[model samples]
Target: MPGSEAIRELVAACVGKVGGPLVALRKIVSAHGHIDDEHVGIVADVFNLSLADVRGIVSFYSDFRTTPRGRRHIRICQAEACQAVGSRRLTREVAEALGVELGATSEDLGVSLEAVYCLGLCASGPCATVDERVVVRVTREELLR
Candidate 1:
């Protein structure tokens, strides 16, 4: 979590900018890892939006998390291109190997498994990312390691 002062500064910096609320929220998530209730309130207040409006934005975007993710985040591409190339099977295998379901963090908090739409590597379908590093034609073995 960032200090209140830092959060305030982040929100203040986006004031009056186009899409300031979304930008501020992204900055908060980038700096603090997640958007908590307090952060929601601060962003709403800073942007003059209703609390519901702010919360709606957070919930609508899969990129925004209300809680912290694990130390290692693994995102498997599930776009039609990837799915056509066996991303579903790959997803299942990775989840089974990691003992964590998609959109969930492991009990030990060491890894979080998530599904994303695409990685812009459609030619190399069934791609995934480990800690933000793209892996084309990723295997369960590679993800587990």
Candidate 2:
């Protein structure tokens, strides 16, 4: 976590004259990987919002992770379309292989596994996005690779 002073400076730069809390959050996340309490407080102060309000925003959005992610991030589709194609089993295999549950990061921070509602690849059910690259018809062996 960065010091309060550093967070204030970063917040000042990200928060424009026009309101863009979502965009500012993205910028902060991109720069720091995650938004800690200090970051949230800084943002709330800059935006003139309460701490709880800022926390609510963070919790409402799936993209805003409160904790740090691993070097590699993995998001598997878990919606009806993906589930129909055996995404459940694939998710299990991935969790086992990585030794971490969904929404958790590996001990060594090698990977962060998360379940997304959809990747907009219904045709390619059981799809996954690894580091922002979409992979269709993902299999356990392929993911392990």
Candidate 3:
């Protein structure tokens, strides 16, 4: 959401002089919570990348977001192991409880739900990561907590 000059300065600060588009994008996302269209332009100009290039990289990565995210981010594992443990049901129930579908943020900005393929905790599946902390064997009650 920063202006061109501000974004340039921010990227420059992070990269010193020659900034990488991917790295600058990460910086913007970390600082601003998401990258808007304006940010994509700034990143493209500053990194000598095309707008399409920036958009492609952003969309390809699960970590990047085109819009603002909620204060708390929730990622549920949907891998085979997690699915075997009822992650699909868990995802639906959590979505219903939060009133937001997968890959959506609540209107109140409390939480954003995303489906992740794996968390490496498959053995303890139905795993979830809340605000970046992995929670194993997650349940609806645990999500509400």
Candidate 4:
């Protein structure tokens, strides 16, 4: 876990420069595997930041995680526009069929399910996600098969 001291130092340096401090932290989280007890301590200690400041950054971003996340993060739009096109029905069946809850990943690492407010593809509606990619006009069969 500590093999990359040089990388750690590089991270420490770059972290303070990018936009606000919070944005820097988010960059690190995206590059690294997961943020947990170790990251919380190391990031704070290396950057000479406070624990409250670090945790505060995490709380602000929906993308940030205190625990671990699946290798892939998936999102399904539940916007009114999407619902009008049957995204609600699609989301329910996809979650059940995949055996994963909203905001949770399947144990097998296939996908993670999340409800998104909108994807700006209202014309397509019925939006879904695979990893970071947004899939529009998705069907239950499309979500599962």
Candidate 5:
């Protein structure tokens, strides 16, 4: 865990950087609960990024955290390109097998499931990323397999 003081300092920075309701929710949950969401609203308000801009940023980048992430983030590509192969089935299987929602991680701290438009590995057709690292081909079995 990040040191409390360090976390507090970061939180202060975040507050200064982002004073929106979404950011406030992030702070509240960070100080209280163990999870939060990818706060697009907060990011927009903080940077004065437009809603469209924020949505684009959030949608284009899978690395941004809207909520508190689990130990690991499992990002699957649901873009037309990836799905053209078999990413759709793979996504459903991962979510179902993990017993969690698309944006949720398992209770075991093993993985969190998410959908991405493209992983920039279009050649791979069916690609996914793990924690902003390890872009690789994925199948339903391979995901939970």
Candidate 6:
């Protein structure tokens, strides 16, 4: 975790900028992996917002995480197109194989499983992402490897 001074400096740099609070939060996440309570306080103070306001922003955005993700993150598409192509079955199988439920990280923090609404590969439905790399027509066998 960065020292409070460091966090304040980071947040201060975003002052007078557009969407300062959101930008500051993103910067903090980029530097520290996730935003914690201390970060939320610093951001709120620097941006002249309430703690609830900053917390609300963090909670509202799926991209923002209050905790660090695992080393390998897997996002299985659950959109209409992907579901039509057996993504539901694939999701269940992958979750079982990984030993982690959706929206959860493994005990060893080596892997995380999450549900994504879409990956824009509708034509190739049943898509998933392994550490940010999109895998089309994904299968349980392919994901385990």
Per-model lDDT = 0.91, 0.86, 0.85, 0.72, 0.63, 0.90
lDDT of 3 by residue, 47-107 (tens): 7778999899889998888866888888899899999989999999989988989999988
Query: Best-fitting candidate, measured by TM-score?
Result: 1
Model 5 — which ten-residue stretch has the worst lDDT? 32-41
Candidate maximizing lDDT = 1
Per-residue lDDT tens digits for candidate 2, residues 14-35, read: 6664656766777778778888
TM, every model: 0.94, 0.92, 0.90, 0.79, 0.58, 0.91
Ranking by TM-score: 1, 2, 6, 3, 4, 5
Summarize candidate 1's per-residue lDDT along 38-144 as a digit string, tens digits: 99999988888899999999999999998779899999999999999999999998898888999999878899999999899999978999998999988888899
| Model 1, position 41: C-alpha lDDT score | 91
lDDT (Cα, 0-100) at 57 in candidate 6: 99
Q: For model 1, what is the alpha-carbon lDDT of residue 75?
A: 96
Clashes of each: 0, 0, 0, 0, 8, 0
Better candidate by lDDT, 4 or 6: 6
Q: Give the winner by TM-score: 2 or 4.
A: 2
**Colliding pairs, model 5:** 36-67, 36-68, 37-66, 37-67, 38-65, 38-66, 38-67, 39-66
Ranked by lDDT, the better of candidates 1 and 4 is 1
lDDT of 4 at 116: 86
Better of 2 and 5 by TM-score: 2
> What's the lDDT of the predicted structure labeled candidate 4?
0.72
Better of 1 and 5 by lDDT: 1
lDDT, ranked from best to worst: 1, 6, 2, 3, 4, 5
lDDT tens per residue, model 4, 119-144: 88999988878777788878777676
Tens digit of lDDT per residue, candidate 6, span 1-145?
6788998999999999998898998999888878999999999888889999999999998778787788898899999999999999999988988899999988888988888988888999799999889999888998898
Sequence-dependent TM-score of model 4: 0.79
Q: Model 3 misses residue 23 by how many Å?
A: 1.1
